[model samples]
Target: MQRTKVKELLAGAEEGKEVLLKGWVRTKRGNKYVTFIAVNDGSTIHNLQVVAEADKFSEEALKDVTTGAAVAITGELVASQGKGQAFEVQATRIEVLGKADPETYPLQKKAHSLEFLREIAHLRFRTNTFGAVFRVRNTLAFAVHKFFNEKGFVYMHTPIVTASDAEGAGEMFRVTTLDPINPPRNEDGSVNYAEDFFGKATNLTVSGQLEGELAAMAFSDIYTFGPTFRAENSNTTRHLAEFWMIEPEMAFYDLQMNADLAEEFIKYIIRYALENNRDDIAFLGQRLEEEDKSKPQQDRQEMSLLEKLEFVVNNDFERVTYTEAIEILVNSNHYKKKKFQYEVSWGVDLQSEHERYLVEKHFKKPVIVTDYPKDIKAFYMRLNDDGKTVAAMDILAPGIGEIVGGSQREERLEILVERMKGVGIHEEDLWWYLDTRRFGGCPHAGFGLGFERMVQFVTGMGNIRDVIPFPRTPQNAEF
Candidate 1:
């Protein structure tokens, strides 16, 4: 017989039919009369119970079968005798595919701390939380591609090794072939010997937006969903040394259009996850309820697993200018007590706290804050008529401060050259990019959405590490 998914079988199926199932045992319960085992195959959230009589399957087989052991069972599906379950399989024949010794297996039936789980990432997926997170992560990624592909956006693969600092943050992980102990030096004592990878010096690309923009000019609509690297050492819930970014650049588009695309894109991703992974969401809900059974209903709603996503996906996101958001922050009593470390002026880069307040307290929804100061934004952003702000926007959601960062590109050759010079970015560094503007550039806009942050927001997973399967953080790359 063909193998059947546990979740599919439990949903609705013939009770008396024979089926073959495969998965690792999640838990095992038994009395003297019979034994029951719950197994998950990473197909869905639901686990199938394997019911076998003591006289039917040997006690030695049952004794050898522990949690985390992989097994294949040919059984007859039957209406579940267990409480709150729909269907179960009564094993006719059992096969032990792989045995995970109880003494050696890291994951057990007992609850493990997230930090402890992080140490055993190789086996972490066996846990329900990580399984659901990774599954939704996969779905969200699919939704991103589906949204862009359906809209005629050409997917472009930008280079991982590049010569330009797209964000100008100086946080690149350098890619070189030079000896660190006895490095070659130029006449002025600077690093020399332009014989690095691909001849000259190179490093990992921070954002694909620059190359993505070049592609957009030719393709009219283009996107890049790839891994971006940053060497920043800041340790926080949001920061990661290496993470994936989804960037979409469009030709003949303005800043407003960019913001609108971001809002709609996020909504689509959330809707996709909710529609396809309802069982995982429900499992998380039940776990939360069990974790805090005594909590009041009002308190529960505040931290419900799916409330923020439902709100953002169902409702229209709020849009406001950077100036207006600053005004609200200055006047609001809630923000008055909390002090910001950075300058709170109109042109300064808004801190994470300010962005969070705008979404969580003021707008009470996702807010698109646009028209940021040019000095605080990237060189590619189009300058506004006010002679100060750039046509830049950030999609700030309630839990995750800034989910998407985007801007309308400065297409004018003269204006872009001047902007690049003003930011101290060498014009020669971006000669090819400038050539595109001089030849045939149209008004273009694009944004970068942090993939892990999006997953963190959707799943209400507090740490960025928990969202990614093997999180790459500062000085930490354990499996």
Candidate 2:
């Protein structure tokens, strides 16, 4: 009487049991003796085959059973005599819930490019590729909360709009309710934010690390997982205007502790995905392998997607100082042959190419590069005793590169104020944040992992845009 999910039926539903199955038709084919309809309800990657005998159902009753059409069937579960699936259904009654015209349907039984799919994001979820991608994304997201909960960390929901720019990059989407054409103005003819909402300038937060730190001061261990926005105009495959971030701030955690937790956290989630979504991962891996066939042998990935994930989980990430990383890069044959697109120097921030070289070529595994120069890093990172570098670290993954960026926070009030002033961040803007140090400050550390990047890494999706649904980029925001 009740509908059964395709996943449950396929898992091990009792044979000969009468069941009601509801799902969209993936494909329908028959030789006039019987109709075999492959149906999927998004429960699992595989489809449940519904066999409708020609004698039992007239031609008119099955005429609308096309791809993308929704259907309901009352059938008897039976051991499948087919090659691929273990079990299928023998339909006794059929109902076409909805019909999709085969001629007009954008998605048919054929390959569609990722670019084309982006244009029709609203319908892309119906595709097997996207279905698998989102399912893996779901598993990884749940794993994040589980990992933190098991570690006794409080999940903190930080503000999305704030007056302070955590990264201090000066690229933020302004949040204000004021006339853009002509409205409030200062004596200097500049736009006056004092007359705007919040009574001061505010923007979509670029990172929750600052607010996360405030919560961590009280809770001792907290993490924020939410949407973060950036106003960067870049249209790269890796850059998105709006994305999700996972930031975990911990009290009394030094740089080493931060790195250790990050390493453990990454491996835990990857292992979780592998354990729970093996079929999906395998599908993506095969998809990637097929895609890689078009590229030159040299440019193709050395390892398959599954192999890369397993390698990261089984192996320990190589740890090196920023200076040591630079040394390794400068002396390497890739650097000598001028293969690197960016220069490798002591103070210069390492680019994606350099990070990938360290992880993919030199180390052949994940690497934690630490103690970067203060000039290139944010003001909040703890200054090293040498006064040249900060207690910062970045976890570089093989293909993705720089999956996690974090550092030990500067708990000393005087030093923090000085660093803020040097970066032109007025103390007035974040006095509440400074209060933690003014009262009872201790050494603390945290890191931020871009959620989409993590999904991209796990799914082996080359473009960051493909991993996230409804990606907001330079000039694209289509659903």
Candidate 3:
């Protein structure tokens, strides 16, 4: 018989029809009169209730039906007598496909701490929280592609290994095939990359935006969605050593257009989650509320999950300049009372605390802070007429600070080379990148949205690691 997923079964499959169900058991209750089995196929957050008569199956078959065990049940779908469920399967035949050793199985019906779940990452997918998280994640990812495809943006596959540091942040994972203990050396005794693979120093890409720009030049509009690496040693809940980024570059666009696209893209994905994954999102919202209850009252959020998503889609993002944002923070009561950890300055890079204050406290909405100091932004960002600041923009959300960063690139060849030199980057190292400006380069703009951070924002997941299936951190590479 063909099998039916838990999701379909719970959606009220025709009653009095024989249906086959295959899935792992979530929970099992037994008495002399009857046995109740909760089965889940990872199709939905809800488990399908399966009822079996005491004498329906053999003792050995019934004994193996435990939590984490895989089972197949052939039964007749009927209206559930249970309160919460609408339909259930009345099992006429039961078979144990695989059994989880009851004594050895790690997962139980009870909730597991998020930290403990990380250790058992391999098994975490079987849990409800993770199941819901990944399901929502899948939908959000699909929504990203759908949103861009409908807008005529060509998806570009950029190289994963590169010699150029796009961010010039000096925090990139080196990619090499040299002997670590004893390797090639130069006349000066430094490690010589001349003899190594790639014929020069190379590292995992920090961002595809650079190559993405090359594609945009040809395709007119392009976007990249791929994994990016950073060697920064930050072990906070907000940081991940390896993550994914979505960058879209468009020719003939300005900083304002870039900010508008980011805002529209984010809201599109959030709205998708709100529409497609209602049950899973609802479960996550309740989970977040429960988690927040343990925090201090002052740390509690102002809006609920559904409400936050709706607010972003329905309202316009507040746009301001870095100078204006600085004034707001500097004049705030927190700064006046000396409660701000990082001092507010016109040219200083805004920290997480400052960004959160602007989004969660001051603006109470998503805000796009633009025109940051040229010194603090990437060299490619176009220099404004004032010459002190670049035409850059950063979108900050209420809970997640700086969700998107982009800029109107410097299309002027001479100015770009001068800025690169001022930042100590040799022009010879980026010949092709310079060629773009040397050729028929036009005014263009783009921005990068960290994929994992976006996932954390939509899921209400506190830690960045929880959103991705396998999280690589400073010292922890365990699966």
The per-residue C-alpha lDDT of model 2 at residue 223 equals 98
Give per-model TM-scores.
0.96, 0.99, 0.98
Native-to-model Cα distance after best TM-score fit, residue 259 in candidate 2, in Å: 0.3
After superposing all C-alphas onto the true structure, candidate 3 shows an RMSD in angstroms of 1.0
- Candidate 2 ranges beyond 4 A from true positions: none
- Tell me which residue pairs clash in candidate 1: none
**Residue 265 in model 3: lDDT:** 93
Q: Give the TM-score of candidate 3.
A: 0.98
Query: In candidate 2, what residue range of length 10 has the lowest lDDT sum?
Result: 7-16
Residue pairs clashing in model 2 are: none
lDDT winner between candidates 1 and 2: 2
**Global CA lDDT computed for model 3:** 0.92
Q: In model 3, what is the error at residue 442, expressed in angstroms?
A: 0.3
lDDT of 1 by residue, 302-392 (tens): 5466776788888998988989998998887765665655557666678888898788767788899889888888889999999889899
Q: What is the lDDT of residue 273 in candidate 1?
A: 95
lDDT (10s digit) by residue, model 3, range 404-454: 999999999999999999999999988899999989999999999998888
lDDT of 2 by residue, 368-387 (tens): 99999999999999999999
